[model samples]
Each structure stands twice: as structure tokens, then as C-alpha cells.
Target: MYMALIELKDVSKLYGFGDATSVALEEVNLAIEQGECVAVMGPSGSGKSTLMNIIGLLDRPTHGDYYLSGKHVSRLGANQRARTRRDRIGFIFQSFNLLPRLTALENVALPLLYKGRSPAKRTRKAWDMLERVGLGDRVFYYPRQLSGGQTQSVAIARALVNDPQLIIADEPTGSLDSNSSRLVMELLSEIHKTGNTVVFVTHNPELTRYATRVVYMQDGAIKYDEQTKLGEVGRYARQVMYAVPETTEEDDLAGVSAIMPVLDKRGVAADKKTKLPRRKSTSHKKRKVLKK
Candidate 1:
């Protein structure tokens, strides 16, 4: 098995010329392993979107070789690039990108249609993808009839309809509320779990919790990132603002004991984190109510 499913060798993407010329990507080099789930974080005009386009095979670099599964693809002709993308890459976007007039199944089937698949085959594959995303019952529902979460699910189905080995997602949860965002984010994680390489782009700090490794960008260049586990973020959530005290088995037990009433008999929180306990106000005793 090759180490890198995708590789960018000193790639540079430039736009304009003369005084107006700008280098969006400047000699960027990186490798993405198979089945890895990563997030690219950057501000607008940081070139993260441009990098995503290049990685998705929707754009080309001005200089250097871009390889997919070890095959250099920068010089590939338009037809060749299209074929490669269709065969091995999938894309998810913030907008969901579903054809509003079409049913969820039809929207998912659109990619297969581009592949010239038979009607029966495309329908079967589309329904299967929909079911995989837990949207079987909504197969006939149109995008307008579905919730934000459901719409993104249909978009995911479309991306996977062709069984692409690589999935590129850009701000996938951008438009959703917390509930919808969690559902869509978890769904994407499951997709990565099933052995497809996933490259996600976002600026949300909390979203980085799900990334195996994060890529931070500024001025079209990578800054700093670190490997992480979202599962570990629970007890460490406050660590971002304050240092984490040394934790021991006893300390954990004590913390759990303090939180016991919050958790029901099943060990699940009954209140679902509506409010947190806070330190007592030091000024409480000094204050007296004035009754006029």
C-alpha cells in the first residue's frame, strides 16, 4: 500500500500578472494518506479554496506535479482529468448542491447518469447510497422537503454514488445549525471510516476536533497543525482557555462523582448540558438588598 494517496510537489497556483499578479499557492508540498480525515482552516482569500479546487481536479497548478494515487496528474488533458475525477474523487459542498427540482434519489443518481450507467443500475446505486446515509425513507423527497441535515445527506449520497476513493468537502457544515451540523459531521466521519480519503476545508475551530490532523493556513501558506482526537476534547474543552491541571485516576474519579447527579441511571446526562456549574461569586456576601 502506498503511503500517500495524494501528493503535491512544490506546487504553485498563480493568478493575474504584472503588478496585479498574485500567487495563491506558493510552492506548497504535502502528502495525504489513504482514508485520512483532515481539515484545512483558513480565512477568505487564503487560497484554501483554490487548493481544494486543485486537489479535487477541478483546477491545475501553475507549476509542479500533482499526483493522485502516485500518478502525476497536472499535465493530464481535460478529458483525462475528468475521467480520473469521475473514477476516483467525490466532492461535498456547503450549499448541499442538490438540484432542488429533483428528488433525493434523482439527485444522487445524477453522478451515475454522467457515467452513462443504465437506468436500473443508477437507480439501485442511488437508493443504496441514500440508505447508507440513513435517508432511505426520503428517497422520493425533494431538497425543499428535506431538512438541512437531510439535504446534506443527499449531497453525500451523490458524492458517494460513483464510489470515489477520495472525498473533498468544502465547508460542509457551514449552513447548518448545531444539531444539523453534528449529524452531517458525524456522517462525514463515517464516510472516512469506510476507507475513503477525506479532505475537509473549514474555518471553525470546534470542527477541528474531528480532524485526524489539521492544516492551518494564512496568506496561502500552511502555518501549524497537530494530530488530535475529538474524543479527547471532552475533559480538555476548557484547556483551551486555561491550563489543564495534572490528572490522576483519583482526580478523574472525583470529577465523575461531582458530576454523578447530572447523569442518570443509564449514565447519560439527563439535562444534556443546558448549563454548567460555575465558581461562586466572591462579592455575594458584601451585597445587601436595598428596599425603598
Candidate 2:
């Protein structure tokens, strides 16, 4: 029987202890098959990052089972987990996470260094990956020299250098402008097309068009999950994008105006009670003094 590429059962993550405990994930269960493009959507503090961390093996769940490639991994030792993470998963971060001192080629080659690849082989593979991501011309450029979009492309190249089966991106375009965001998402979309599993966390509803499925999370639980067609926004996400009323300057001013009376009733009245009396005209006295 076949199994999911990634699976989580009864997963829960908690920080602190006793009365101070804060829950980040609450019995969250999820499964992703191979070659699926999944988008995890939620507000901040909604456990999206926690879930991604667990899936990426950067963090273990406080309570639950995790299976990667149909193998139970929840209880793996730290070293084993790290080894597995390096061999099976690729991560793209919003901050790019590239070494500032290294050129684009060197940064992309860094991951292969961990696997003990020879310098010559690492250089060849890294250069090929960079060329694949349309950054061939920038192989020797430092990260600071690249634009936001180009920097992210280099990051993408680094992620793909390992040829991992799963890609986990945490707000990959969070720090990018609209055009750069689109470019990054397109690169991710291309990766998805090549039969790699992709799971990304995003707040923008419009980006759901690239996802074959959308998972909406809230309060550390999966509130909604749906399979969506490519090139269209998920139904739930569409409702969220369009259902909210827009606010205008006039509306904001009206709201402020409505609250002004209450503010005046409390603050203005107190200020008036503490107000100082105005001084009588000193100009007249000065004029008389000048005449004298």
C-alpha cells in the first residue's frame, strides 16, 4: 500500500510549562502526497510556522506522530533527524538565509559540502542549479549585490541543489515586493511542476492560484482544507479576500469623529479642570513702557 510523502497525526506543540504553557499546535493532523502543491494559510500565531517546522524536521512535536516517506520519524534522535532533514527536505525562508560573505555559487554549494561532495563536483552542481534558476550570470555576485528577486532566486537554487523530495517554504515572498514575489512564486511553481512535493505558508489569497490544494489554519487547528484547481483562488480564500468590506479615508475619519465625543468627555474634561488661566495682555503694558 502507498502512503503519504508527509503525515502528521495528533500533533501538538507547546511552549513553557505548567500554568504558563502556550499551545502552538493542538492535535493537528495533516497529510500530503507526493507532487502536491499545498499552501498553508493563516494569521500570525496560528501555528502555520510551527507546522512547517515540524514537517521540515527543524522542531519536534511535543505530542504526536510524524511520518516522512512512510517512516515514523517522531521519535528519531536529534542527529538522525538532522541527517534525514538534510537528505529529504529543502527549505526556503522569507529572509533568504544566504550567507552574506559567500557568492551565489558558494552559498548554493554549501549544502553539498555537508554531504561530503568534492569541491569540483559541488561547484559544478551549484553552478548548474543557479543556471536552472536563471541566475547563471550572477554566480559570483555576493548576496548584497543582488536585487530582492535575484537574491531569492539564488536561495531557490540553493534549496534545489540537494534534489530533495519535499520543499518547505515559510513565507518565501514575505520580504519581497509584488513583482519579486511573483517571480519567486513562479520559480516555486516550476519546481512543483517537476514532480517535487511543495508546501508553503502564505498570507496572500491571490497566491493560492499556484497551489493545487489550500489548507486554512486557525488557533492551531485545521479549520478548512480543500482541493483547488490551478490558476484559481481557493473558494474559502476567495470569500475571505472579497467578503471583508474595504475601509476608506472618509470612513476612518467618521469612526474617529464618532469616538471624539467620548474622548472629550474623559480626556478633554480632565484637561480643562487642570487648565491654567490666560495671562492679561502684556502687549499693552509693553507699549505703555515704551512710551514712558
Best by TM-score: 2
* Candidate 1 C-alpha lDDT tens digits along 131-193: 999998999999999999899989999999998999999989878776777777788888888
Each candidate's lDDT (Cα)?
Answer: 0.74, 0.82
User: Which digits, one per residue and each the tens of the lDDT, describe model 2 over residues 48-148?
Assistant: 99999999999999999999989999999999999998898999999999999999999999999999999999999999999998999999999999999
Error of 1 at 142 (Å): 1.3
Worst 10 residues of 2 by lDDT: 271-280
Candidate 1 local Cα displacement, residue 106, angstroms: 0.6
What are the RMSDs of all candidates, in order? 11.8, 17.4
Worst 10 residues of 1 by lDDT: 283-292
TM-score of 1: 0.79
